[model samples]
Target: MTSTDATTSMFERIGGSDTIDLLVDRFYDRMDTLPEAKTIRAMHADDLGLIRDVLKRYLTEWTGGPKLYTPEKGHPRLRQRHFGFAIGDAERDAWMTCMRGAMEETVTNAAARQDLDKALSGLADWMRNRQ
Candidate 1:
């Protein structure tokens, strides 16, 4: 008989910021080398340090942690921020591929992983700026 409290939330169970940081790091690392990610990769500067940090912070707030990103960056107009880039199906798919790989490597809970993946799939499609 396991108490429900014995189970941690995905956000807490994954070791919080540390796990998110590792995932973001691995995600950017994959982006650096994946041929499919070349176009999206080119959109970013060579240095991925800041990008990784921002993503980690963003995820922290997004996944029921402290409100890190909102206080620092204000509203996260995700679509507006990404509007500068031509995000077609290819770019969206590439980004999702990297994220999926990273998620698989970092996240442990089956339900949590599925929830995040489904949400991400919708968000990635919504971010598409091009046909």
Candidate 2:
């Protein structure tokens, strides 16, 4: 890693709040339209407004940005929160399909995008609760 990369958080490396917003927006847009994403998309509410804001806050905190999520929601028991969903490899893949595209679109820094992709992939895998 470069000296700057070592010092900077992923949030800063990926362009902070603005890029995060773009990424989340693009991800949801993909989820809304992509054929492969239909099943996962059905898991969400008809009105995506609340979930969109929640995702923005969660990603902001997750990418080493400000503590935008925890102050209100506390430690993210992410799996527990998602236990209601029957997530498996297909669901994970569908989520990643949206996220990878969003990352490619908004995270201009190549290294940061790769790093975020790996991390997100892991997180998505962990989110899977079904066989």
Candidate 3:
């Protein structure tokens, strides 16, 4: 049977810093090149390195790993932080396309990928500010 210990964080289940790094890297790489991600990609800076590091840190703390992000950033303020960008259904869908591809390529466990996808969908939807 699969280990379902309550104490186990998704961070641990998904591997660790290395896996998070790989996932973030793959995510941005997809966003950088995928034709489907073109619109969403335009929203980001040409240099993805900074966003990549922030995401890695955010995901680390978000998934119950060490508190790396909050200590530095105070709070994620996800929606407010994204307010500058006009996120709509198309943008959210495009973002999800890259994320889904990244998760599929990086996450080996089916159950874990499903869980991440569900949560990511909600978060991405919430980021949308436009109709």
Candidate 4:
């Protein structure tokens, strides 16, 4: 069987948009205080409200729920959007650190966590716009 057949869609595994919303909220909370995330946090504005919603919607579509992100923000073009930032190894790691922590806190299912981790890692690497 193919990987898709073997694995559950991230939407179902993640308990849908509500769970992802919690994950994104927790991620930003950690980023707001974590020293490791300071640099990356600096890239964002003081207000995280919009970012939280954007991330939740983005994740909702990315995880196979509904295509809310595109409907609202057009194509994701994640690399293009992130290209404006100085995303080097440090920034990528910092983002991943917060996300990993959030995942650990929000996702109780081992398989779901693994799936989300793998997808996030790939997306993080893809978002790296600078060396």
Tens digits of per-residue lDDT for model 3 on 50-128?
A: 9999999999898788999999999999999998999999999999999999988888878777777887899899899
- TM-score, prediction 3: 0.93
lDDT of 1 by residue, 32-126 (tens): 98998898899998898898889988888877677889998999999999889999999999999999998899888656677778877998999
What TM-score does candidate 4 get on C-alpha atoms?
A: 0.93
| Cα error, candidate 4, residue 35 (Å) | 0.3
List candidate 1 stretches off by more than 4 Å: 1-10
Compared with the true structure, the alpha-carbon lDDT of candidate 4 equals 0.89
Candidate 1 local Cα displacement, residue 119, angstroms: 1.2
Those runs of model 2 whose alpha carbons end farther than 4 Å from true positions after fitting are: 1-4
> Lowest summed-lDDT stretch of 10 residues in model 1?
1-10
Predict model 3's lDDT versus the native. Answer: 0.89
- The per-residue C-alpha lDDT of model 1 at residue 56 equals 86
Model 2, 1-131: lDDT tens per residue? 34668878889989999999999999999999999999999999999999999999999999899999999999999999999999999999999999999999999999889989998999999999999
* C-alpha RMSD between model 2 and the true structure: 1.3
TM-score of each: 0.88, 0.96, 0.93, 0.93
List, residue by residue over 1-131, the lDDT tens digit for candidate 4: 12853666678777887789899999999999999999999999899999999999999989988888998899888888887899989999999999999999998887788878988999898888888
Segments in model 4 whose C-alpha atoms lie over 4 Å from true places:
1-7
Clash pairs detected, candidate 2: none
Instruction: Count steric clashes of candidate 2.
Output: 0
For each candidate, the alpha-carbon lDDT, in order, equals 0.83, 0.95, 0.89, 0.89
Cα error, residue 86 of model 2, in Å, equals 0.3
Worst 10 residues of 4 by lDDT: 1-10
Clashes of each: 0, 0, 0, 0
Let me know the TM-score candidate 1 reaches against the reference structure: 0.88
